[model samples]
Every structure is written in C-alpha cells, then in structure tokens.
Target: MYQCEHGGVVRLKLAVDPDLGPLAAELSSLARGAGLDAVGITGAEPFGSTRRHLEQRKAAGLHGGMHFTYGDPARSTDPDRALPGARALVVGARSYRRAAPAPPRGNGVYGQVARYSWSDHYGPLRDGLGVVARHLEANGWQARVLVDDNAMVDREAAHRAGLGWYGKNTALLLPGKGSWFVLGSVVTDAPLPPTTASAAGGCGSCARCLPACPTGALVEPGVLDARRCLAWLLQAPGTFPIDLRPALGGRIYGCDDCQEVCPPNRTEDRRHPPPPAGDEDEPWVELVRLLERTDAELLAHLGRWYIPRRQPRYLRRNALVALGNVGDGGDGRVVRALVDGLAAGDPLLRAHAVWAAARLGRGDLVAGLAASETDPEVRTELAAAGLTG
Candidate 1:
C-alpha cells in the first residue's frame, strides 16, 4: 500500500513501467552527488495517519492556533495537492546536527538556539533536491521540488520512502542516524518505483523523550501540544505565557530537549565527527544585544526565520524572556535592557518586559515603572509582582 497526498491510499504499481528502476537509481545518485545524505521514493498517496493526527490534535486545541499542516490538513497531507498528477515523491535528508560549538567570547547573557536554526539547512536541501528535479525534467517527467514547504507533509513522504521511521518525538528518525536530519521531497507526475523497504525503527521500550520536555509539551508518545511548546511559542506572536516562562529557561528559539534525550541521537552524536567550524559557527545569540539592534539590523541577522508577522518585536520578546532567565539583574547591561523594554512601543513587548522585570526581582525597577505604567496590562504585572508603591 502506498500513500497519496490527497486523502486516498494508492499503491504505486511497480509494473507500470520497467524503466522506473533505472530512473529511480539515477535520481538517487544525482541527489547524493548534490550533497543530500539520503534519498528514497514513495507513492504520492495522502498521508492518512498524518492527516488523522493533525485533525484530532487540532480538534483538541492541541495545535495551539498552529496552522502549518493544521491550517488545512487535507491539503498538507495529500501529495497531490502540491502537484495534480503527482505519482511519486522523492524524499531527501540533509544533516543539520553539528558538534556543539562553544559560545562566542564576551557575552553578558547567552541563550540557546536549536541546531536547525543555527544555519540555513533548507538552502542546501533545496539545492540538492533541485538536482534530482532537473534529472526528472530531462527524462520528460514533470517534477516539483518541495522542501520546507507548507503545501506538503515531508516527514510522511520520507517515512513512506523507506528513509526513516517515526520516533516518539514525531520526528522522522533515520536508522543509525537519529532525528538530526532535515527532510524534503520532489513530487512528480512520473511513476517512479517506490523503495523496496523503509528503515526499520529501533525504538523499543524507550520513553525518555516524554519526560525530557521542560514544559511537558510532548503530552504523549509522538503527540505535542503546541500551546506548551516553547519552540512554536517563540515564533508565535503575542505574549509569552506566564506559567511557561520558567520552563522556557534560556532558550531563545526552538527546543531540542526531546532529541537530546533520545538514546539513538546521543549514541550517533558521540560517534559522528563535529561540524567543520566547531561550535563557533553556531549562532548562539547574545540576549542583551537583541534590543540594541534596529529593525533593519535584526532582520538582516534573522530574516531566515519565521518571525511573528515579520516583526522584530517577537525576536525581542523571546530575548526578553531569555534575558530574564539567564541575565544578571546586577549587570548594568541588564538594567538598560529592562529600561528599554519598558519604553518599547508595542504592548506585547511592554507586557513581556513586565514579566521579565518581575522575574529578575527588579523590585526597585518595577516600583519606578509602576507610577509611569499606563498600559492596563503592565499595571497588572506591576501589582501582581508586588511592585506597587
């Protein structure tokens, strides 16, 4: 049984054409030559399981207003939505996991960023997928390259392609390689042969990932409540939830706790060689510097990510929380950050600053802020934190 993207299960009849074997072989070679770590093919069937999961979770409010695949599951789960005549999907994986890089020298307060965000993994993955798409085009088949695209469910494509299995964390884990790889695919009208087999999963009784979450975002095996997820919340607009602030800790963007605790990922991490530039290449952002940058400067640095409506305040919002958690209240730099946050234009930023100021136990700072605070929200923050004069 092969999965098609549009709410239907279809078998990719291998006997449709004998030449598919050679074509598949050539495509895989092209992908690897172009720098992809893994490549495999599967039918463009709608990922029924993925669709069901998304629908169920959204209905339960577990999606937390997340629209990615949930905005319209039927479209995202069906490969055909990406291309009308799609017959097969060629999934590719690229490794973004690098050896831990040391923090840049001289920092007041440092916050952690997920490994995937440290560099643009999708750029290389897209380039590699393009190589195969060109090959298919040369062979007279319509091919569309999709990586990090909202129109497709890439992990389902990879799973059906035999490249990996679903780990408890909902990540597609490549056997022996773990969940450190980024996945993408080429959906085409060509009826390529599906891979003979998928990588058998090694996860047995292990459930370490569930408990590894700081906020228990992973509610059950492979199921996540996006409302509680720090990664999504960071990119999510508006105020950072007060209850979850402590769990957010020093993470400015993305949370890798589940993957960090996975046995397979850890084992492979130990054996694999570190990234070329070491930890220095990793973009471990300095918390205090966030508020210092102008909108243009901040955009130039992190334009790659999905900021809340492309606004810089969301980035500053996350940094404010990080600064509150890891920053030294005694440091003059931290004092300036708190002060600047109080003067910010956005109510969201102002509200978050209130939380951060309270977290740092900057009572004197908050007391001074109380008198001048006009925003009802900020006033509530001051009173709640006992900063009321």
Candidate 2:
C-alpha cells in the first residue's frame, strides 16, 4: 500500500531488514556527529514527477548550457545504469543556508551568489557518505557513495526516504529542517529495507514560493523552466540572450532571489552563521569585486567549494554579464577591467566582455574591442554590446 510521496503514481516496495534498524540509528548519529542535519535510506527507483519535469525542462530548451545528467534517461533515471547491482540508496541532507549579513548599501553594489555555491558541500558530503558506506561494508554489504554529478536524483530519493518533500521552488523541503539543506547518497548492492513512510510534504496551501520568481521559471508547482531561471543563465557556458541581460541585474554569479524570497528559508533560527572574515560582510557578495576576479583568483576563492567540471571561463563570462548589468561608463575602474578582459583568449570571455563594455557606453571600448576581436562570435557580441546603450 506504500507509495512514493512525490511520485505517488509509481509503486514502490520496502525491503525491510532486521539489521537496518541499528545501521540507520548509527548513520543518524554519525551524520549528526559530522554536522549533517538528517539522513535516511530508500530503494533505487525513478523519482516520479522529477523525470517528467526534467524532460519538460530539457524539451523547452530551458536547460540552457547545463547538460544535466538526468537529461538522458538511459544514463540518469535507470538505477541499473548507475550501479548494476544497486538495491537501496542511503540519502543524507545538510544545511548550508547561513544567516546573511546586512549589506552596506550605497558604499558599493552587491552581487548575490546562490547559497550552495558559497561553500564546498561535495568534499564533506562525499567523505561522510564514504564513512557510511564503509560502515555498511563492514556489515557484509557492497556500498558506493555518489555526489551531485551522479545520475541519481538526490532530492527525489531523500523525499521517498521520508527526509523531505519537493517545494514549489523545486528544492527538497523538510518539515522542520527547511529547504536550505544539501543532499548526499550512497547506492549499494545490499538489500537494506526501505523506510516505511515517504516524506509527503506539508505544504498545505502555502504558495509562498510560486510568485516569488522574477522570471516565472516555476510555471507550476514543482516545475522549473531552467531557461528563465537566472541560475541557469549564470551557469550557461556560451553566449546568453541579450534581451534577458538587464533582468540579470547586479548578480555576477548565481541568483538567490528565488531562495531569498522563500518563506521556509526566511526563519531566523534556521539561518547559518556569517562568513568568518576577509569575505563579503553581508547582504550579498559584491558585484565590483566579482567583475575584478581573475581566473586564478576565482579558482583560488571558489574552486575548493565548486565542482571543477566545466572550465573556469564559464564563470568569468557570467561575471562579464553581471558587470555589464551594473557597471556605469563613468566608473573608470570597471571600464578598464572590461577593456582588459576582452583581450583574453577565451571566446566566451571575450564575447561577454564586449557586451559589458557596450553596457557601460564606452565608445573607446568598442574601438579597442574591434582592434583585438577576431572571433566572429565576439565581434557579434561587440556589435550587440555597442548597440545596447
């Protein structure tokens, strides 16, 4: 009679094992001892609505530049593809949404980085899951832990395991823990029993997250249009649509506007602590500093926290878009940076720089860009940037 809470139409079974009780207890304690918020176990199965939503998101070209693993059904949805012998998944969640410090307005422009990007969740999550896997291995079971890059839909697994439910923003929302948590999982060949109950969310008519999106990316409950999603725009690897450039505002990296506006995440107690020192004080990361970060500087600051899957140039290009959105031609410092940035070898980098320079209304920048811009794509960007303001 038990069913997946989020994907209720799908039938699932709980393969209970007597030994799992102690192991679950041990994992709960281990996760907490290691600073994790919650952890649970579930069988390997397709997360009902996620597959449908992912297909729709991809079909609409909303995927932007991110070719998500799940975008391919054979590779992502099928548990057999990820691990031939996989039977159950051990899912874990952690809270990284800290209380943001107040922004010192007027003194400087602020840039918003998505909460997840602010820290490195993979290392700790992987390490903890590895420990959990080892514990299961000791009990005569085969275990393997995977992070965000893997094919499995982590939020779906966690929800089915009674860890949380999908929110209107498409994030996993736990009852008391809030939606600010990061997820981790350990897929194993062992036949561990599944949790008796699925995490049917208690959203209860609360549509707080639906209308908060600036781009209307969340078309309906639990659906996200990645094209309109500013987060995707920032992460896209190639030239962005010039029309949406202004809506990007001062966001140099990822956009937290949607999450920032989430009611569940707004609670004061659930907020994480402030950045320790020598970092952006509050409201958000600053835009001027984002535009100024060199490749090495960006890697040095964020490389440890973010997965180095794509080249760092993608992020630099995003910075250019942000700078163009906020930069005024009057600010000689930013203009010079944009001018200098256009000379870089990466076409994506050069292209975005052209756009930024144009937004700042620098005729000198256009001349300089014309002198060095060889890539046809960049030349197009230069022409577009020049026409913008």
Candidate 3:
C-alpha cells in the first residue's frame, strides 16, 4: 500500500494479465484522442543513466547554476519520488510547431520570441496528459499528471517510452516529427506494458546544430553549457552577461538558433507545413512599450514566463539589451525609453539602459547621468562604453 498526496492509501498491484497490452493500447488511444500528438508507455523505473549525466554535468559546472533537474537529480530521475509505488509512466507530446508570423512593421523596435513561447503550449500538453490520468483514476489506479514540473524528467521519460531520440541540441526528436513538441507524463501505479522499442532513427553524423548556436552553448553533442545558452541566460537572475549581449540580437526571451538549423526540423517543416500562426500568437514584442509598462502591467502581460524571482525588472533589462541591438537612435520613443531606463531606480535596468544608449550612438544621453550614478555596476557599464573616464 502507498499513500497518495491526497491522504488516500492505494494497494499497489501488478496487473500481470493478458489485458495489460490492450490496456496500454487503449490508454495511448485515449491520450491521442485527447489532443496528444504522440503517446507511449514506459516503466516507472529510476532513470539511472540520466541521473549520472546530470550529476557529472552539474559537478563540471555545465549546468551553469541551473537548478532544474540538476537541482535534485536523484529525486527528479525517480518516478517513485513523485508517486510512491509508481509502476508505469504514460508519456505524451503535443506539437507546438506553427508557421512564423510576418514581422510586424511598427514604430517601436521589436524583440523576437522563441517558437515554443509563442503561446502556452504546455497548457494543452498538460490537458492531454490530464485526460490519460483521469482515465487511470477512473479505472481505480492512482495517477498524477506531471508537465513542465521539476518532479520528473519528462524528456528521459519520453525517450524511455520510445517517443524520440535526443538530438545534438539536447531536444528529443521524434521520428519524422522533429523536436517541436512539448512533453509531459502521467505517473501511475498501474502496471502498464512499456513500449517495445525506442525511436527508429538517431542523429547519426549530423553536427549542424553545434555551430548554429549563437553563443556556442552546445559545447558538444547532447551537452549544453547553460551559461552560454541565450534561453537560459534570459531566465537567469542578475544582469545578463556583457559579452553575450550583442549576440542576443533582438531576442528578449529564449533563443532558437540551434533548432532552427536542425535538418530534421527543417525537413519536417518543408514536408508537413505547419498552420500559419494566428493573431493570438505573440512572435514579437515592442521594446519601447515593454520598457514603458509599469510593474503591474508587465507582470500581467508576461506572468506565465519564468521570470527570475518573478521580478519584472528582468524583462526591462532584456528589453534594454534588445533595444540596444535593434532600436534606431534617432527615434524619439527609443530615446525616451532609454532615458527612462537610465533614470529608473533599479540599477540593473540603468546599467543595461546605459549599454543600449551607447550601442545606439546616443552616448550623450548617458554622459550626464553617469556622473551622478551611484551603482557601481551602472558606472562600470558607463565606463565600458567610454561615457566616463
């Protein structure tokens, strides 16, 4: 017997019967019918190799202070930690792929958003997994849905379920389907038969994604130095690194350079074109407007995103860096945004704004402010830009 999170005890039973295979098939169908693009089952064994990899990488500092799966590899890799007496995992993937929207033509400089974040893809993925979990519960099995949660390593679970192989970019690539899907799992005590095989193909000799990384974050196949990854950097706390700011281009959140160059992803796009994005998709954000938003407004707009400590200033800091890369110095609105950033109380924002001002050739705006700047970090930025001696 195992205790569930809701304070209920469930007797653990191995459903070792002829019906296990058919049950797995039925669950798969249920998952697909509920909107999952891909679904498979695997045992709820601890991901031993994945735990070792996480530990080794974390020890070597490849995790770059990231504390997701790396934070507690043992607990994350073991499905039992999520649900005691867990016997199987029903993994599901939902495709978030969509045609890129045309770049908006506007007065304000726009910041590029990564594809996965164009909308809340995880919500749909979770909804699909919830369907499977509900079915298990209705069958007198204890099931818990895990999506984008640190309690489980969903990718390894997907791979173990024969969903896909790990791409050199570290994304799980499904056969003929590419890596444009978000993954989730339903951990349950039901003894379901595992998938018979893994994804049919592997990355083979292709290494295109390694060099395609804007910041060389891949380091090598299947390994990422999160310190240099733009996606992780955007979500990391404190100031964005100075050296990586330029390569950041106009990206305010996440980066897709690696996946954008993957041959399989490109092939998938050409073969089965995704539907064009609708007006609801936010592929771009106006930098000036983002900078101008109040703390409440900013949080309301991007509350779903993983902002460090849920602070809105990180958004502004990212916007300032993007503005520096793409904003026209001659534009009054651009200048006004930078001025507001430079004068803002947050030293982090002021520093990034200083860099943006200098990048836009508007050092005159920062020269006067640097003399009275109290923050050492802001002064350092002014000094680096030659705005101060």
Candidate 4:
C-alpha cells in the first residue's frame, strides 16, 4: 500500500506487486504536478569523480574560499552521508526563467540581481520535493530532501539521473531547456531504477560561455575559478577586488553573463518565451535607496540572500561598488549615499566607499578623509585612488 498527500487531500494506491516502477512513475508525476519542471532518478553511488574535482579545485585555490561543497567534498559527494542506506536519488529542477521586467524607472541607480535570486524559487522547489518525499515516507521508506544544501552535489546527481549535460559554465543544461533552473533531490532508501536515457546532447564546439564571462572565471570548459567570478565576488567577504571592480558594473548580486550568451539558453528563450516577471520578483534594486536603509531594514529586505556571516555591511559593500560603476556623480542622492558610505564607522565600508567615490569622478569627496583615515586598508584604497598625495 502507498499513500500520498496532495493539496491537503490524502490519496492511497495499492502496490500489490513488489515492483517499484509504478512507485517511481507516480513520484515523478507528483513532482511535476507540484511545479517542478523536470524530474529524474539515479543510483545513490558516491560521486567519486566530483569529489576529486572539488578537492583539486580547492587545493588550487579555484574555490576562492567558498565553503559550500568545498568545505567537505567527501561529505557533499556521498549521498549516503545525507541519508543512511540511501539507494536512489529523485532529483527535481524548477525553472527560474522569466521575462525580465523593464528596469525600474526611478531617481536612483539600479543594481542588477541575478535571475535566480530575483525570487525565492528554492522555497517552491523544496515544497515540490517535499511532496515526493512525503509520498516515499508514507510508503514506509526513509526519505530526505536536500535543496540548495551542501549535503548533496545536486548537479552531479541531476546529470547522473539523465536530466542534463554539464555546460561550459558549469551549469546543468537541460536538453532544449537551457540552464536557468534550480536543482535539488530527495535521497531515499527506495530501490527505484535510474533513468536510462541520458540528455540527448552535449556542449560540443560551442564555447560561447567562456569569453562571455566578464572576468574570465570560466578558465576552461566546465571549470570555473571562483576567485574571478563576479557572482562569487559579490557574495565574498572583504573588499571587492580593485582590479575587477570596474567589471563589476551595476550588479549588486550574482552575474548571468555566461548563461545569457549560451546558445541553448538563447534559443530556449526564443522558442518558448518566458512569462513576465511576477510582482514579487526583484530583478533590479535602487542603489541609493538600498544604501539609505538602516541595518534592520536592509536585513529585513534582503535577509533571504546568503550574506557573508549574515552581516548587512556586505550588502552595503556591494551597493557601493555598483554605485561606483553606475551611479551618476552629479546626482545629489548618489553623492549622499557615497558620503554616508565614506563616513561609515566600519573601515570596510569606508574603504569601498572611497573606491566608489573615486570611480565616479568624485575624488574630491575622498580628499577630506585622507588626512584622518587611519585604517591600513582604507589608506591603501586612498593611495591607489591617488586621493592621498
């Protein structure tokens, strides 16, 4: 006997036969019905190759202090670590693609947000996976859901499940579907058969994503150096790299240049136009407004994002960089934000503020602080900007 709940209604189906094919099919259907765009199953064998890649990358400093999967490659690559006796993985991908909204018309400079972070897509993805997990558990099988979590290497699981191939950008590109999806899985003890047919194609000869990378983070096919990735740098702690700050452009969080240029992604968008962004989607943020917010206000607005050590200052740090690149120095509001940032008590903020002011041709604004600035890091920025004689 198997039982599952959908839309607050309990449904039961008899599984008289010992075969698990029917169960797997039903779970896939449930996942799709629950809003997942794709679903596939794969064995729970450890991702040994992936573990080696992570270890090698971390050793080479390609991870750029990223601690997610790199923090514990062994633990992250092994599904059994997530759920003991795990025999299969039911992977799901929820599409995050949507028609980008027109840039908000406002008085302040706007910072671009990566498509994935525009909304809480992961929350819905988890709910969809939960539906499948609950079904498995109701049938007396142990099931655990992992989404955007370090417990499992989701892309590897998705690839093995025949969901997609690895793109040069290191994203799982679904056949005809592109890479604009968030992936997750339900690690379970069930002995479901894996998807036999692999995603029909590979990224052969098309290396558009490589040069498309603003910072050359995609050093080679299917490899990314996080140290130079604008997406990672925005979330990274400390000062944004001085050399890469100009390329940072107006992005306050995440970078999509690679996928934006991928042939498959572009084609997908043409064939199946995505729906308009929802009201809740935040594709752009006002830089001056964001800088003006109080600590509590900033956190309340963007707390869902992965702020380094959960500090609000990092958010301001990013905004300051974006302001430097896009903010109009002539705009009084922009100057006010830079002024606030330069005057901030935290040296980290003050240092980035100095860079922003100088980049916007407002070096005069930093002159006043040069005499009084004592922090070594801020002093370095001042000297680099030539604000200090």
Candidate 5:
C-alpha cells in the first residue's frame, strides 16, 4: 500500500518480477562507494510546494536572468514528464563540507563562494547518478537521471528520500552532516524500497540564517525573496534594481554569510583545500580589476568556476559596484579599467560605470568617458551622474 503526505503520494511496492531488491541494493552500494553520503528511493510525483515557490520566484521577477529551468514547470516537477513509466526516483547527496579560509577583514573585500560551488559538482555527481541509472536500465528498468540542471526541486526530493530536512535557509540540511552537499536524482520505472520519513528540522527557533543575509533575502523560515538575495544579485543580468547593489558589498561570486553562521555548518569537516591567498582565481575580485578584464579573459576565468550563461554585462556591472564599495577609486588602474569598459558597448555597463564613478567622486573620469561616447543612452547616464563635457 502507499500513502500521500506533504501534498504528494508515496507507495511501497515490489519492482517488476519481484526480484529487484538485490540489484537495487547493489546499486545503492555502488553510489555510496562513489563518495555519496546517502542514497534513497522516493516515489515519483510533483513537488507541489517547491513548484509553487519556483513559480512565485519567477512571477516576482526574483529569478532575474536565470530562466533556463524556470520555463517549464511540469517538466521540472513531475518525474513522469521525464520518463513516461517512471515510478520511482533514486535520490543521492554528496557531501562537500570543506573548511574555508577566514574571510578578509573590514570592507568584506574577499567574500566566499557557496560551498557547493567550491568544487566541480556536476561532472562527478552526474557520473555517479548515471552509473545508477545504467544499473537500473540493465535490469530492464527505464531510467533517466539528472543533477542541478533539470527542472527538479532537488532539495524536496532529498527530504522525501529521508536524506535530510529543509533548514530555515531553505537548503536541505542533513542531521550531523550539515547542508554542504550536492543532490541528484534518477527517475525510473522500477519500484524500489520507499525511504523512511526524513528527520524534522533541528533548527529549533534558530535565526542564525536570517540575520546573516546581508540583503535580508531570507524573509522568513524556509522562504526566500531572491530579489534581495546576494546569491541572485551576482548572477542577475540586465539592469540591477538600484536598491540591491549596495547590499551586494564586495561579493564577486556567490554569498555564504548565512551558511557561515550556521552552527552545524561551522562544525562540519571540510575535505577540500583552502582557497588561494591572492590570484585572479580567488573568489571575490577587486571591482576595478574585474572591469579591467577583457571579455575573453572574464569568460575564461568565470567559466572555470561559474556557468557563464547570462549576459556578460551584468557581471561587469557588478564589478563596477564592487569597486565603488571597496573605495578603490583612488587607484589609477581602476580608473583606467572603468574608462575602457565605459568606452566599450553595453549600455548597462556604462550606466553602472557612471554610478560607480560618481560614488568614487570621479566626475572628471565620467566626463572623460562621456567625451567620446556616441551612445545617446550612455550620454544620458553620464549626465545623470552629474557629468557633462
């Protein structure tokens, strides 16, 4: 028999031909052997709450330029949409808890990347999931697998599979193991052992994650307003809402304040090496240097860590703001980079540069960039920054 809880249905039944348990167990063993902390089976169904939240995130324009998975709700939520006969989902989580270097002092000059992004999660996680999918398919089960790329609400699947519970930050936090893990799933026709109920949250009225968000993006327990989130800010393209830029501080990559304050996360064992002391590859960049990077150089550097899917203009804009925040305007190098980026196309970058130059009391530089500027919109922005040549 099966049960429906949390607005979804669950069933426990034998796989086809009733001889599937041994093979499924073997598949589970292989996944664990591959460095995954946990693997469990869940019944296929739409993750209702997660889907609704995702829709709300998009509708509120909180998704910014991150529209790839936002375009398809059914395909993202319903496993059946991925595989017609998919009756079960095999969910897995790989722990990535590594110690981080202490953040640099004062101006928040060197912000940290989120733990999951600290390593190349996709290739290894997908490889392991694919291996499990193959094992199931070899046993005549139709299987399809995916990691963060798909339209799936992976955190909910992890919870459903008894791997973890959603913390106040909306991340899946496994007991004693923390939330620094990457999640993946395989959908298939095989009926496997249903996972036990996941542990209820251990947060217990803790508000550590809430106050730590520089932009107050947490909103409330288990709810997030991505509009104000620094995580979204770094990846957002096009025009940034004026209100969000200052809150970004100097974070050039992603935000980690919330996780850094969490008790469990603080104690977790970090297996990866510490980040570099100073290099082009360090997590946060001096806004001035980022603006200096050519499009090709920026692409090469960011592609090593981030997926450069959005328009490059947003990243450059962010770099400009970071420069302003760090008070790096006195440097001739930064001034030169701003001049170069201003000279280049991309009205978005020009506008941000105007704002940055004004904040740095460099109206003269703005005037200089505006002198040869042919774009009417850019001239308007320069004028708005109190620059006229």
Candidate 6:
C-alpha cells in the first residue's frame, strides 16, 4: 500500500497482488509434462524490431501480396492489441521434425508435402499451451492461448524467451536441437519471470540454407521474398507463374529443401528414431486423386491447409502443375485430366490444362480445345502454345 497526500489529506492506494508468485516453476513443469519440448517466458512488450522489419519489407514489395503479420505489423507486434493489460507471454515450442516417410509403394504420380504439413502438429502444440494458459487462469490471472495465430509474433516471443536463435534461414534453432519445431504462446497478465537474454549465435557462417532453395526464394540470410517462395506460391490463388512452374517439381503443398539441407537438422535427425506414422497423416498425396477430389472432399482432406478462398480448384490447379512435372506423359489418367481440364468451364483450369498437355507432348489433344475454347484467357493460353486452331 502507498500513501498519496493531496491538499493535506492522506489517501491510501492498495497494490494489486501479482498472482504469479512461485507459479513460474509449476507453469514450466506443467508445459513440459503436457508435451511441449521447450517452454520459457518473456515480457509482453510490443515487438519493435519485428514490427519495423515487417513494415520495411512490406514497403519494399518483398511481402509479395502475402499478409499475415504483414497485414498490420503494429497490431500484430503489440500484446495489448491482442489482449488488454497483458504483462507476460509464456512461449512454447514443439518439434515436428520427423524422418521423411517412405516413398509411395505403387506406381502413382505423387507430390511431396513439407514435413510440417505431414500432420496436424499445431493441434498438439495448442493443447500443451492450453495447459499453461489454464494453469494461470486456475490461479487468479487472466490468460489467453495463441498458436499459429496472427495475434502475436510468436518467433519474436520465443526468441526473447531464450528458446532459440534465429537461423540464417529465418527459423528458430533450438540449442542442441535443429529448427524442426512449431511455436506458440500463452499471453497472460501474471507477472512471470521473463528470460533475460536470447540464445547466442548457432549458425556461425553456414550458408547452406541460402543456396538450398531450388527457386532462389531465400534472397538473403533471415530475409525471404514471398513472391519467389514456393510455399507461398502454392498457396497463392490464380494461375501458377509460367517461369517458376517447372521448378515446382512434385511439391504439392510446402517446400522443405532449406530445412532438409540445414546441417543442424540432419545432425538432429540422426540422433533420434523416426517418428511414428498414422493413416490420417499424409506426407505425399497422389497427384491424380488430388485433381479428382470435389470441393467437399478436398475440404475434408486438406481443409487445414491455407487454400485460396477455400476453393478446391486451387488445389486442382496445383495438382495439375505437379502432374505435368512428374506424371507419365502417356499415362491415360494424365492425358484424360489434361483433356478434361482443357474442356472444362473454368478458365483458370483450362489455361493450366493447356500448358500441362503441351508440356507432356500431347499437342495433338490441344487442337480441338483451341477450336472450341472461346474464353479470351483460354485463347491466349492456346496462342502461347502455337495452337492457332
């Protein structure tokens, strides 16, 4: 309690009790037992450095129409913007690093998904963070859980919490462990002990991740141009860019080349046994089946992904490109898909179909399509293929 003298009258100001007394250890212990691999705390001040970086990159056109925290850096960086009167953030990290699954058993054209998308890693991560948040709530503090959410800059919080340092690839690298973790946090009003200093440099001059990009997406250390990023390109709606289409290879979802080539990741994997697999998890999806899935079916399967406008055609668009990259040029299904897409009503599908068919040396099927196609976009696509009919 404090006394304030005003006009010769003494008034007492009662101090609010900080409920987190002696509870930090319990929070960390509960988080670890709840399945989180790394847990730490930090003050919930606005992430100034991160906000400036976001604003600067966005102004430079490096954001490439991509908007997450890039949408509004000021709001995203401030914990108060997410929750009023927030004082501390309890950050959590869970490893999604798993040995690559065995290649497809049968003869089927398939597209590889990034290891992170192999399953719902965020679900378990959220559960662990929930335990931490509830623990704070069970006491007398107001707490909120955020994971893979735009509410806060999770990596900055994690870094401040001494969880790890940012690798050249812009991923957080755990001390001995690699950058194979999914991050999240619990924002609370409790006055928890915050980590003093961030982890020191782990990537001493290793530039392997820089040249590892097949599409040259990594413009520099710790900076990425989303336009050139294959992961973002796949999620971006509209036609896949012509020049980068071939570089896509058989990647249907996210790209993991940078992480795969990271020396730390390779070393970390060798030390642990492969993570178990399940029928629900898919490291790769059959190209033909993906193209054939209906909107409902696509949602049922890939809804967790960041699909463009929640439409199935976008997935079909990506599958079509992957098919052109790896599908047998003469496979009946491949031929049929190309022909069907060429004859379809959607100009986006029709345009990509023209490219895929011609790419597969099925120039013969395009002649009839060129004659029947009336959409100016489809005509332009055919003209590009040298099909005048």
TM-scores for candidates 1 onward, in order: 0.93, 0.82, 0.95, 0.95, 0.83, 0.93
lDDT of 5 by residue, 1-389 (tens): 23366755444444432355676688889888777788987888677776887788788776655654566866788887888867778999986655555655644234345656655666778888888998887765678887875657677788888888788988888887788788999988887767676655578878799988888888889777777877776776556666677776766677778887887776554533433433322444545555666778877766655434645566677777776666566777767866776666677778777877787787777766767777776777677666867
What is candidate 4's CA lDDT for residue 177? Answer: 93
lDDT winner: 4
Top candidate by TM-score: 3
- Which portions of model 4 miss their true places by more than 4 Å? 1-18
Which residue pairs of candidate 4 clash? none
Give the residue spans of candidate 2 off by over 4 A. Answer: 1-14, 46-49, 104-110, 198-200, 268-297, 305-309, 368-375, 385-389
Model 6 C-alpha lDDT per residue in residues 310-360, reported as the tens digit of each score: 988999889888888888878998887887888777899998888788788
**Best of the two (3, 6) by lDDT:** 3
For candidate 4, lDDT tens digit of each residue in 165-260? Answer: 999899999998999999999998887877775748799999999988989899999889999999999989888899999999999899999999
The C-alpha lDDT values of all candidates are 0.85, 0.69, 0.90, 0.91, 0.72, 0.85
The total number of steric clashes, by the backbone 3 Å criterion, in model 1 comes to 11
How well does model 4 score by local distance difference test?
0.91
How displaced is residue 250 in candidate 4, in Å?
0.3
Worst 10 residues of 4 by lDDT: 9-18
Better of 4 and 6 by lDDT: 4
Evaluate model 2: give its TM-score: 0.82
Question: Model 3's lDDT to the true fold?
Answer: 0.90
Model 2 weakest lDDT span, ten residues long: 274-283
